[model samples]
Target: MKNWIKHIVLGLNYLKSKNLIHRDVKPQNMLVANNVIFKLCDFGICGTLKDSISSTHLGSMRYLPPERLGNICSYGTRSDMWALGMSLLEVSQGYLPLSSESIMSFMSHMKNDWQPDIPTTLSQQTRDLISILLERDVNQRPRYYNDILSMSSMTTLEQNPSEDERNLIENILKSLPIPTPE
Candidate 1:
């Protein structure tokens, strides 16, 4: 999972460097191949950063950033970062942070001050990283999440957690909408 996050960030870096923004990012768009490497897919809504016409609602409603939903102003690479954060949370916890059945329900769930209730089992570093990525205030969100993930502390995942711990983590991961390749 740690390496998965790293590769996702690396993918984002490559996209950003090329002045492109993938307006949509979620677990469905991520494909883990060969039981090891992770690849990002779905570029139907991709657009150049400088394109104002591309600022419209072209991405998944659930994965979009707050600014894009409520405001008319254009977004930058940070918007994609927000989606990345949401995806990271899902991949880490094996479930989406928010769920709604209808459009109205979805909008209602995205209150201005809303924050996802993160699980208690996550390490402090992972929690902090997700919080930073899911920050409602766009300015407060990390400008470069890859830097945060590359931190030594963030990479210190247990090589061999106890059987109980391993089972618990596996259970969480199995609950995700996307199946983990075996």
Candidate 2:
């Protein structure tokens, strides 16, 4: 998980430096290469940031941040952080975090500042990162990938996945269904 997060942060940092916003950031949009390297793909809805804000509302509804839903113009890299947080939460817990039956309920939950309960099984560093990434206030959330990369929670992490993590990843990859050409 830490390795995955590191690669994603690097990708986001590059995009941020280019003034680009990858509007869609979900598990499906992430690709694994050689069963090791992680990459973000499907930039169909990517947009350019103007004055640190992106006005267009285009992204998967489930992955979008509350600010984009409430006010399209009131979003930037902070919105991407929210989506990234949701993705991390899903990956960590093996399930999607939010499950509102209807859009109205989801909107209500967002307006109410609903946040996923961080699973205690995760490391303290991972939990802290998730909490900060999912902060309700956009201003409080990390606006750039560096903001997260520079955190003490992230600073102590190893740059590469450990042997145990590599084994676990290998096992998970081996268990996945192979795609059959259409």
Candidate 3:
């Protein structure tokens, strides 16, 4: 988990340095290899950082930041941090942190202060990181990727997904249908 977060932070830093923002940052777009390497994928919705904070409500509904709903608020790196927090929760709990049948329902939940219950097993550092990442007010969240990377208690990818678990994941991925490019 620590390793995954580290890689994500690195990737986010790279994007920020390039003046880019990945409008969509979710588990589906994150790839893990050897249970230690984290790779950020899917740049389809990525846009210039300067233009990211504009009148746009783009990104996967499940991972959409609170500011992107209804109000003409602009988003920035904090949006991705929200998604990252969600992804981390999903990984730790083996399910989505938020539950809703539709985007509207999800947004409603967010508006109502429906934050995920912190897991009992998570370390204090991890918990702190999540709390910051999932803050309702984007301004209250960590402003830079280094803020997340600096934590000493972060878990590395090597600590998660035992070898057998990875094999099962490999099999599952192999069973999925591949979408050919048009």
Candidate 4:
């Protein structure tokens, strides 16, 4: 999972360097090759970051950052980071972190400053990374991929988790109930 995340961050970093934002980041948009390497796709909704801001609200509603869904105006790379965090959380748990019975319900949840419940089965570093990534305040979230990579959680992960830990995570994932279509 960390390997996949690293590739996603690398992709985001490349986009950041070019002042681009992959507005629609989700599992559907992430293509995995050979069951290992991953690549972000679907650039149709990507937008350019102008002066560190983007006014357009074009992205999968479920993965959008709080600022994009609210009246906040400074949507930029941080929005993509939120989506990346959601994608990572979803991948780790085998389901979307937030589920809504209706669009209104989802909007309400987003409006209430709801934070997903990170599973305790995950390592503290993993949970810490996800928690900050999903922060409701865009200003508080790491603004750059380098900033994210610099986090102790991210840096520790880059060193590679032990094989036993990997096995334990794999087991935990296997134990999670598969989510049914809503």
Candidate 5:
């Protein structure tokens, strides 16, 4: 888990350093060649730092940030962080945090500031990182890649996690409150 997160943070930082925001980051865009190796792909909706907030809705609905849903808010790299948070949740749980019936329903949920219930099985450190990454205020999110990489939990993932680590991850996934279909 740590190693997987490390690679993801590294890739995210690389993209931020290049002033690029991968507007569409989802499980589908993340290709896992092996248990320990993964790659982030699909730059179709990527935008430069200088690009203005898009009026057109883009990216996968499940991964879309709250600010993108008709709010007057302007988004930046932190928007990617929101997507990263969702991606992490997907990787850890094998499913999206929010599985709405439609894009409009998803957007409505975001507008209402609805957030997924954090899994109790996650380590305090991991939960803390996710909380900050998924904060409603984009300005409060970690700006630089190093900020995220510097996280104690993320740094630990640079190497393979032990069996105990896998157990911890599984516990966390199990703790999540599964969303029921309406």
Candidate 6:
């Protein structure tokens, strides 16, 4: 999970440096190989950043940040950070964090004080990182990928997946049905 986060942040850094915003930053768009390397794909909805905000709405409903939900007219990397936080939460808990049945309910839930009950097994560092990433106020979120990756705790994590995590990832991968070419 730690390595996965690092790889993702690295990818985000690269994309952001190029003035490209990956509007869709979710677990589904990420590929993990042998629980070692991670690659981000699916840039179909990506946009070029003139300053830092994009007014267009183009990302998964489940993974979008509150700002992207029209709480504001525009959003930037902070929006992607929110999705990354959700993706990490899903990975840690083995399920999507939010239970809202629709967009309206989801936005309502986000507007209120909504916090994921992170498993106790996860480290405090991980929790801290997610907390900042999931901050309701975009201003509080890490502005750039490196802002997150530069954390000492994040950089010091071991580059290994425990047996349970490996098994869980393998099972999830196996259960996903591959689509045939058209």
Q: How does candidate 2 score on lDDT? A: 0.80
- The 10-residue segment of model 6 with minimum total lDDT is 66-75
In model 4, what are the clashing residue pairs, if there are any?
A: none
Worst lDDT window (10 residues) for model 3? 153-162
TM-score of each: 0.77, 0.88, 0.81, 0.83, 0.78, 0.88
| Inter-residue clash pairs, candidate 3 | 2-155, 3-155, 3-156, 3-157
The sequence of per-residue lDDT tens digits that candidate 1 reaches over residues 8-127 is: 777877887787777888878877653445678998888886642246567888887888777644666777778888887876666776563476566556646568676677767667
Task: Summarize candidate 2's per-residue lDDT along 43-160 as a digit string, tens digits.
Answer: 8888898987777778887777777777745558888899999998987776776663487787778767687799998888899888988888778988678878887766777766
In angstroms, what RMSD does candidate 3 have relative to the true structure? 3.8
The regions of model 2 sitting more than 4 angstroms off are 171-175
RMSD of each: 4.7, 2.1, 3.8, 4.6, 6.3, 2.3
Better of 3 and 6 by lDDT: 6
Model 5 agreement with the true structure over 96-137: per-residue lDDT tens digits: 766745767777888786876767777787777778878877
lDDT, each prediction:
0.70, 0.80, 0.75, 0.78, 0.70, 0.82
Better of 3 and 6 by TM-score: 6
C-alpha-based local distance difference test score of model 1? 0.70
What is candidate 6's lDDT per residue for 47-156, written digit by digit as tens? 88878877677888888877666657475888999999999898888788765357678777776667767778888988888888888888999987888888987778
Report the C-alpha displacement of residue 2, candidate 5, in angstroms.
Answer: 2.3
Across residues 1-182, which tens digit of lDDT does each residue of candidate 4 receive?
66667778989889878988888889888865533556999999888989867788788888887677775765688888898889878877778866534767777788786888888877787788888889988888887799877766556664455564466456655775999999
Root mean square deviation (Cα) for candidate 1:
4.7
Badly placed stretches (over 4 Å) of model 1 are: 51-54, 154-182
TM-score of 2: 0.88
Candidate that beats the other on TM-score, 2 or 3, i.e. the better one: 2
Clashes of each: 0, 0, 4, 0, 2, 0
